[model samples]
Target: MSENEHSCYRCGDDLPGHARAWDYLLPDPVALLSDEEQDRLIGVRTEQVVTASGVGNFIRVILPVPLDTGHTATFGVWLCVTSRPEWQAVIGAARAGGETWSGYTFSGRLATAVAPWPEVFGARATAVAPGPGLVAQIRRSDERRLARVLTQVWPDSEILAARERGHVPGVMTGDRPRWRDWWRRGRRKTH
Candidate 1:
């Protein structure tokens, strides 16, 4: 691939030959709810996961909730968007390997199991070079299915911890992506 070719944000691999003929399907945030027209979209289910197509890739999660909720639900979903090349690569490779779900720690290993949820739920997203970004909306049904699948795949404690943490590991870690820092450093040196 030529240096001019753009790569996936989550995975650093070149987007195959060119940015033509890419496929994408982002799930609607309310598709899993009983009433799709409800104005209020609170809770963990209202989230989006952005990913790239082909090879290893990472997901960019976006949350639509306040810091605190009145009550905790049985399971929670999360949205993440990373500007880091490493994370993108990690997720891309995992996807290609047919490993979907992932977690930050051993006790929070939800990433590996959840990885396949996107594909199974018809939310699998792909982006070619020079194309629009891809975002995936996971619903209650997907969560329930994923949770059920997790119980058999990973330890009970790990699965439970993932639920408590909203099925996202290191989610609250750094404030922003690493690329910002790199940009800052470069600007400072140039100045």
Candidate 2:
């Protein structure tokens, strides 16, 4: 894999002949939960194991019991723990229904007859991509969270004003029109 490419064990092709390492990437809500929250989300029997490597740090969370999140399935989460504080904050924020950040954790069971979902990880555009359901869930969650943030930051009036004036909204500087901004709507239809 290239330097910039994702070297995540769960998604990387380094392990030859391995169809995929994961069955389902962890849902956004589950990944963002605190350790305690994860225990509750997965169940009382959740097991956490930490491992270190040159690439990065990792934590494997094992759930033996099937829980309810609209379905019945055992979940195993793999977290890329580059930073504990950041990952904790990400999970906490997710649980609180706030920010959308990565490093939450990846979830999946082994790809076998017993597994509920396909074993996959990473974005679809990549050579080694995650399952469609997993991608959709993550994308939808992030989009919803982002939309919420944008809505709170950009009120209806600001958006309407921006649209009418042909300018981006949420700019405090733009609130006070500058002499140099006479060309805010410089684009005119050429006939």
Of the candidates shown, which would achieve the greatest TM-score relative to the real structure? 2
**Please, what are the lDDT tens digits per residue for candidate 2 over residues 9-40?**
64564433211223224332233346774554
For 11-71, candidate 1 gives per-residue lDDT tens digits of 6667643232111222222222235332343222212333322111223332111112222
Taking all chains together, each candidate's TM-score versus the true structure is 0.19, 0.22
The regions of model 2 sitting more than 4 angstroms off are: 1-47, 61-71, 87-119, 123-191
TM-score between model 1 and native: 0.19
State the TM-score for model 2.
0.22
Instruction: Please provide the root mean square deviation of candidate 2 (C-alpha atoms, Å).
Output: 20.9
Locate the minimum summed-lDDT window of 10 residues in model 1.
104-113
* Clash totals, every prediction: 24, 6
Give lDDT per model, in order. 0.29, 0.29
